[model samples]
Target: MNVLSVALSVLETALVFVVMVSVLVAAHEYGHYIFARLFGMGAEEFCIGVGVRPLLTWGRRRYRLALSESERAALPMAEGALDAGEPPRELNEETRFTVRAWPIGGFVRIKGMVPQEDGSEVRVPGGFYSKAPWKRLVVLFGGPLFSVLAGVLILFFLYWAVGATRPAGTSIEGIVRGGPAQAAGLLPGDRLTAIDGQPVLEFYDVVSRVRDQAGRDLQVRYVRQGVERETRLQPKLAELPDAVMGSDHLPTGEMRRQAKIGAAFGLVHVALGPVGALAEAVSRPQQAVVGMIAIFERKVKVEDSVGGPIALATMTDAAVRQGILTLIEWAGILSISVGIFNLLPVLGVLDGGQMVTALIEMLRGGRRLSYKVQNAMAAVGFSMIVLIVIGVFFVDIKRLVMPSRPMPEFVPIEAPKR
Candidate 1:
């Protein structure tokens, strides 16, 4: 692609990434808003994207049709008053809505999310921290739950559309030299009808049966050229050097274990389509969460797993080139990542911080911390998060500017003219 085209592609990829992140964020905030509404607490404002004022409204009515001369003139003065802690004749509708200059993410605002110290009280009813602990947990849990649900839905659709792999025909697509299947005289296109006298419908069934066998014998049924045959295949439990978890991969041990099946795709397994899809969807989020936890625990190094905007855009671009189904899988994985990360209960910058605080409260017996304290902590957390984001942005930019080295050149000899 040309420079402009490449830039556009990158921009589009970034936008998709932002949207995925923002949607998950919106779901999390919506959780808080819904619960706030349910608890009879006031929810002052909700919005989908960040930066710049798109339109202004109060309740369900559009208050400011456009940024008029009158409205513009009133903006500075109104903002000044609001900043000064002077309440407007009524809560300014404009204050309740905003469109920021940057549209990277979205947020929700509750009137009294922070607790006040010095016995000072919140006059506004809908602050987040003011709600019951259970309510707080619901709000806190919402983001991850939304993300998981989103994954499930995506998986369901993907599965329903594509179906899952099963072991009906035992055919070795390619066997490693000296590997178990190869040693058993198994050849490509061999139909595996059974394992250990048990009829197997899916490739996964054979894999599952074989995995626990470490050193046990596998009785396989095969049909080759219209001939039925059985063979005793001893599965050699080889200590393969990390065949999975690539340098850029950060899957947990659990994830690795679940995906370690080697079975041939066949017709009988394909018949159980819905079941396969459902299983795929449900397992996705769990995989993501475990991956994240593994990364966090230093079991997986950040350098081995981390990717900034550039890396992600590059991956997305690659996916786009590969085809739609591949792209959907990548999108699903990224969505799950965004969802899982945002639920990390650290109370400040991301939605998870408040959740962590709420969880802490749940574990410890005490009146909730003052809103002021919570807010201050949140602010600190938010500031730190902003710094990290800035750092990532620079890292991404650095990769763009610092061109990669050209591959080493090798000279080739010219053959004699014939």
Candidate 2:
């Protein structure tokens, strides 16, 4: 593609990525808003982006509706004066709904979440801090819970519309040129029936056997054009790219060595009924959560396994090229991943961190932690999150700018003439 075309494509992809992210964020924040409202913790403001000024607004304290700059400034100023103990101009009952210029993420502001150090308290009814710990816990859990539910719903719709994709058998779909499989004369239509005389039930069985015998010759038996054929090939040690590992961490600069035959194959899609679709949808998120836990436990390397926003956008672009079904499935996966990550009980400004603070207060028999200590914890958490985002961006840039080395080829041994 030309420079202009490439630029446009990148911009388009970025816009789509931003829209998808905004939807996910909105879903999460809406969960908190709904639950807060349900429990009488009134939301002061519900916004779908972050900025000093909103581009559009609804509900109470509305602005930018063909109003002049001075007029717009007067609204917030009046509210500020009222907040400063001045006489109320009018009692505003509606919660502000805003759409900011920056469409990155969103937030829902609950009333009286913070404690006043001067021994003063918010006299407003249904303040967040006025609720019991259990109520607060439910509110805190709502965001992640909604994210997970969104993922499941996406999957259900995808399965109902398209189908549930799963492994069918051990048929080879494609082979990497100059790789072991191609060199071994394994054609695309070939089906692996056995390996070293061991029956191959599925594609994974063949992969498992090959992974265990790197650099060693192995007998492969397959059906080609309805004829049983035998040949010998060795799995080569390849320095695979860290992106393949699908972790969230940055690349370690050290390549991961893995055994590979350089062939790609996967399951076929089967149309599902409503019940089957629901089951598949539920199971998929559970598997994603388990996989994420594996990544966190260091059982998997982040660079090789995890992907950040760039990777996700790239994947989404690829899915768009493939079809809408693939894109929907990817969206579901992304939602589930975000949901699980947000629920990690770490010392940060995340939902889990807030939940942890509430839990501590509960354990202390309703005694709250000092604001100073909470602020320190929040600061540390924010710093850690910032560092992680930087690392992910670095890895993403490196992957885009510097491609990995080409895969090494292997020469196959000729089969004896029949």
Candidate 3:
């Protein structure tokens, strides 16, 4: 490929990675928002990104009627104020959505989720801690749950619209323009059954038959939409890239003359019924869990198996080159991974650790940790997250610099004097 093509490919890879990450993150945040709303632990703000200042801000800042008269006076009031011992003039809005100045990242601020929650929570009636411990557990679980569900839905769609690949005895995936296949009235989705009156079971059968019969008109029999048909085609002799020496290395700059219909043979999509699709889709989460276990058990080397954003871009680029179905499969797997990662129990900032706290509070008969302790955990958790990100980036860079499978060094050989 030329330099321009390489640049374009890299651009496309970055775009796909950004889009995939954005969608999954949105799903996760929306999950938390919805569950908080459901349990009356109303959120204070929902912003696409945390920024220095908001680009556009709307919605009223409703004053909590439960706050003391003096506290109400000190608070900045929007809309209007209420008289002493009088009710609020307008209904309170639980949350206000904002578009921030930053173009990337997102955050949802749940009410009374701060370190000073105890002191400030009096301003709001249904603070997060005010809810039952079980309710808190459910709220914490919501984000990961949504991410996994998104993966399941993607898998289901793929199964319903594009079934798994069938390599052997596959149908014609595409017809080459202005080539023999097009000239002979051959179209995509046609299943090759025979060539020149000889039974053709695999791709090799067609290759073997046509490779030696160039320039000779041969009977090509195929099944199209359940109807058997026949056509004749004269295979053209074309010089194509044919690589050999395939033991961990392939020789470059090699070409061979072979017969060609000028078409690509690939997997055929056989869509499944709704029931079957749904069944296959839901199984993905379990498979993902098993894989995670394998990684943790040291059966899979961390360096070989795990990577950060850079590695993600590289993998995404490779998947894009593979085919549409392969890319879709990668997406489904990635969505599931996002859900799984959030549920890691090691970090206080993650959903799993928060759920553990909720469970512990419930077991301790409603007693909760002090704000100071919670703040410490939050600080440590955030610091740990930052360190982890840095570590993963370093690993990705190292892997890129020193690839596990080194590229073969080729010694160019001048063409022998003919």
RMSD versus native structure for model 3: 13.5
Give the winner by lDDT.
2
Q: What tens-digit string does per-residue lDDT give for candidate 2 at 1-418?
A: 8999988888877777778888988898988988987776768788988899888986564221122232233334454666675433333445788888887678898877766774233343456776677778889889999998999999988888777766667887777777888878786667888888899987557756776578898899998777899988889766532222212111222333457777766568788888878877887566666566556766555665666777788897887778877777888878887888888776647888889988987898866678678778888889888888898888788778887444543333344333
lDDT of 2 at 398: 78
By the lDDT metric, which is better: model 1 or model 3? 3
C-alpha displacement of 322 in model 2, angstroms? 3.3
lDDT of 3 by residue, 8-64 (tens): 988988777677766777777788888887876657877765588667766535533
**Leading candidate by TM-score:** 2
Weakest ten-residue segment in model 1 by summed lDDT? 241-250
lDDT computed for candidate 3: 0.70
Tens-digit per-residue lDDT, 1-418, candidate 1: 7999978877877776666555655665666566655554555567666656745343442232223232233333466576775333333332254434454556666556645665332333334554566677777566566666776777678768876543344554544455566566665566777888888655555655665576666688876656877777777553321223322222223533222223223344242368657766766776766667666666554544556767786787787778777777776677677778777655666667767676777777536766677778878888877776787776667667875434322222222122
lDDT of each: 0.59, 0.73, 0.70
| Model 2 lDDT-worst window of ten | 243-252
By TM-score, is 2 or 3 better? 2
